[model samples]
Target: MDEIDDSQNPGFPPPSPTKENWRNQYYAYRSPSGEIHYLLLSDFYGHLVKTSEDVIGSRFIKKKLQTATIEDKNEAFKELKPHALALMKDKFGSRVIKSFFEHGLDLQRKGLAEELFGNVYTLSLDQYGCRVIQKALELVDMDQKIKIVRELDNHVNTCLYDDKASHVIRKCVECVPEEHIGVIVSVCVDQIVKLAQHTPGNYILQSILKYCKNTLTQKRVIDGIVSSLVILANNGFGNYVVQCAVEHGKPEDRSKIVEKLAENIVEVSLNRFGSGAIQKCLVFGSHCDRKLILNVILGSTDRNEPLQTIVKGQSGKFVVRTLLKTCDDEQRELILLRIKIHCLEKYLPQED
Candidate 1:
């Protein structure tokens, strides 16, 4: 065989031993502004797709997807389609996928959503993939939103409890249309207490209370949580679920929560987290319930020892301030008097 050295052929460039050297062989050019800018010899989109698995390459693709022209972004999406699932599961590639959903053209976004249609649940449950699913839910149209929500229909509770998947489930509750919202609510409602007590699941339940617009559905959620009011109120994450219930629950539901807390006011008020729930009660509880809470804190007309103890503590001070803001004039005077007597004056603002 005759030896042919590529370096001897003027028309052909010598091959580099490694891909990194080959990539570096492409050089930076100085522009009219005197700034050096690197340029790619091959199509930028094609280069990115070829090296999509490389960390630096994937980030470049994400940046281009973010700042590129719509036409260029469409081309990038087409190039990445074949590896969509794999990219979605890749830590770096997932970000590129998310950027496509965020900045791609309408057709590009729709096409990407369609491609991920059947696998929405799987993506929503994967740590990196869940992020892509969340972006789609926020930016895609209603029909696609319905499709994504439907994929999650069978796994609503499962996603609610998973650390990463819970976020997607919450997004679905917030953005999906009413019909799809009904599907999520129906699956989650019966498990409200169980979900509320869970670390991540509580977030999904709170989203249900915040976004599920049907008055009847809201009531059902409230009724479910209220049945376990004390337990939820005392829980670390469950307390926020209680707070959301009070903030969004019906008037009657709010009263029930207030009554439950009132029964254990001092105990809850002294808790590190439960105190916030009690303060929420003061803000949203009925006028009568407010009076009831004050009575429990101040004791009878003669003694204000509980009020003294609460104002002196950390979390309880916030609850006491909330009380001062909402209390009637007579109630306010009594609370102020107790503050003065206890010499916890520093916790209270001095009148101007």
Candidate 2:
């Protein structure tokens, strides 16, 4: 044991734990052998209070305290069993009755979930207490039973207070719904573009573009999402934005997007260019859309270049075809020939 300090000692009257303390507690620590160690053994309220400074021993003390609260687990189950059984009376009644089901859930009583959800078709909109109901549902594997619980998890996030719990519940709710179609994606392109002006993450804009690609309707909406994804691609989310470009039905734009992505990824010519997106564009979209990709390749040559290279230092089917299509016969043969020559020199050797 270590020496202990009195409550009257310096740094005494340790600050009480509040939401602010909760945030700061991640970095705080308690003296393991302190006189206040016993206080760690208090109930949930006490655990919250004692969590001011994180201590290894405090967790064991808290767990012991929780266990101590339950006297004769079977008897506890018996006491709460009647109300749990009554939760299946009617939809509204079951929803309301689920609250009393929590005590039995914590005890992990047998057959409790089937007893509660056998009659209810939906979870209560009041999800604050739904956490316990959800835990109980895990024991019952019936489709209808799971569906009701899944529906509850999907919309419960808006009402739940805990962020992690909200995320988890939402994920569970992703189970196949009886009439579920894929998410009906609608992207506010203008909103996404405008938001990206202030936001740092390009993934949001990419997400919009992805929605447009998958939905493949509302041309104006797709254009907006594409433009936003492209514009934000100048930021860091290059691969995702390029994905949106490749997925767009308009075959004409594929090459342009690929070249731009490849250019930025191969070389860091422009400070604003995102290298990761460019690399993916070269690897994935170069072949699918090479006809209109010359602008990106030529753009890389300007002294005022906006990107580093048009190909990601690799040769592939798209790269070979792109080189072959460098210039038509009627154009300046010398200039076109030189471009073809250099491109072949750069790409063909690797393909071989």
Candidate 3:
């Protein structure tokens, strides 16, 4: 057991259980007579925690949890259940805990979850602890799932932006039913613009769009970004949310976004990121929505001024190109003629 400190050995995989030095390594131990003996899975009674903290030992325990008999697993669980939370935070012990959830029986998982009851929030945010919480969310029953996700009530704001914790919140949104995860909806409770403009928060909003399939639920999420349509459209990171909204949102929602961008079609089409929103609206919006955007760009259709301005600008040029690609033949002819005439006038400057 003293040799469990792995710093002393630099060998690639350490010694295998089948190797000659197995009895002399970390799993090697002493008998009641004070003589050394080989430690087997059956002998994993009192030493589960210590050996689990070792890299090799934890790997061995996880394998046993996977394929070992119920009695062999229960033997390790007897000693492990008490230390569940602490080991959840352990570097190596956490993986062992995850493996247990993966293969442990229901009663055993319930027992393990009880040990994790009040600590779900802390564990959800913890580096190693988060892994265990995610595993439980994926594997635990709904009643238990609600309990674990509910612990994240007020902590979601911090969790939403956190590198590690955000995944837990995302997992809850993903796996938990729409009715039970009001806590996730509450992160965007205000449904404000900043939520869409926020870089990290975009992921949550995107998940809400993709997974929260209920009408009112999806509406709440779509409205949140639509409310900030113009702001998000012009933004760097926020534009992704807008594009996602157009792709996933209802037709009316797409119309709403196109209408908003049409308010300043030329400028929006000229913006670095806002142009994407316009192109997305073209790709996904109704025919009326496409023409609504096109007319805005085709400002003063009788003249070539609007066509020239949009075609001249670098960003707006792409919007026009995308429009040509996505628009129908009738609309393409009208726009293409102006473009043809404009190129002739610019290149055929023989008024010298």
Candidate 4:
């Protein structure tokens, strides 16, 4: 026989049962040649674990699972379940398991959820495993959702800061019910200021504020940020949390942000991130609040030093332009008259 080129795209049906014995199944299977291009659901019979670990093989199984008949899917599940924990952590296997969670039978999901019980926290911290847990949380029943999150109960702070695991915490805040996230929210409440300053933890705080409106928990988080708004706006990372407030918090809450920032307007407008918050005040603050910001921009001292100081800084100059765009015509004229020299320069924006 002529040599069979391994480079050829060779497709192998999933590992088939060996006649030698039941235990011989795993050992009897020999590695097949070439790149796996296509695998049918029925083809996933015995080699499920092997294929689930392969890059192309696992992707094929996931695509097949979506439209495969229930019986074929059950057989694949039987072969895949025992290795579920390991697969959940496997690079490609995790993707296959998530496909099952998304497209497999409801009953099969419960079985996978059982395999994930005590390992949720460890898995949530895994780069691949965290994704599997997130999908399970979305598709599993309430009991499973509670069980999965309960694993992270006291560990909320860790997951909140972890690079991979933080996504799981965010998923919980987004997908789980309010009652189930009390621990997560309570932890955030206690550590609101510190967490808002953390780059990763800030997102968890943002998710709560964005999704949990009207809940007392959201109100407390908002109040916490509002009380510390000035400090947060000045922080390099914490400014994001302050912007979250203007985007998600209530209308009156925004006015409060404008009022609070205006108290330190000159200092804030000169700083980088702090100036961003001032721009938000221009767009989101109400008419009365905009007037407040305009007055601050006009300044109080002889020669209006704050106004001149603001127009010269890089971020502060853009803020001046934004304020001019947002303020009333009368306020704009007063601003234009005071900056008579700047009128000839690019310090001010041209009218559209």
The models' CA-based lDDT, in order, is: 0.78, 0.39, 0.78, 0.81
**Model 4 error, position 52 (Å):** 0.9
By TM-score, who's the top model here? 4
Per-prediction CA RMSD (Å): 6.4, 12.5, 7.0, 6.4
Off by over 4 Å in 4: 1-39, 341-344, 349-352
Clashing pairs in 4: 14-43, 15-47
- Mark the 10 consecutive residues where model 2 has the least summed lDDT: 178-187
Write down the TM-score for model 3.
Answer: 0.77
- Off-target runs (Cα >4 Å) in candidate 2 are 1-187, 208-221, 225-271, 274-277, 290-352
Superior by TM-score: candidate 3 or candidate 4: 4
Question: For model 3, how does the per-residue alpha-carbon lDDT over 48-118 read when each residue is reduced to its tens digit?
Answer: 88868877788778766777788888888888888888899999999999999999988888888887889
Q: Which of the predicted structures, 1 or 2, would earn the higher TM-score when compared with the native? A: 1
The residue pairs that clash in candidate 3, if any, are: none
Report the lDDT of model 4 for residue 130. 95
Cα-based lDDT at residue 141, candidate 2: 45
Segments of candidate 1 deviating more than 4 angstroms:
1-37, 40-42, 312-314, 340-352
Write the number of the candidate with greater lDDT, choosing between 2 and 3: 3
- TM-score, one value per model: 0.83, 0.36, 0.77, 0.85
Q: What is candidate 2's lDDT per residue for 1-352, written digit by digit as tens?
A: 2323434443522344333323211213233344433332232232232331233223332233335445433443444345553333333333323333443344343445545453322333323334434544443344644544444433432423233233223333333332231221222233445434432223333444443343443354435445544455654444344455556435456555554444443243232344344434444453444323434544535331221233323323234333444444443253345446455345333333
Which runs in model 3 stand beyond 4 Å of their true positions? 1-47, 55-64, 213-217, 302-314, 344-352
What is the C-alpha RMSD, rounded to one decimal, of candidate 1? 6.4
Q: Taking the tens digit of each residue's C-alpha lDDT, what string does model 4 give over 7-52?
A: 4333444233223312211221222544323335675577789878
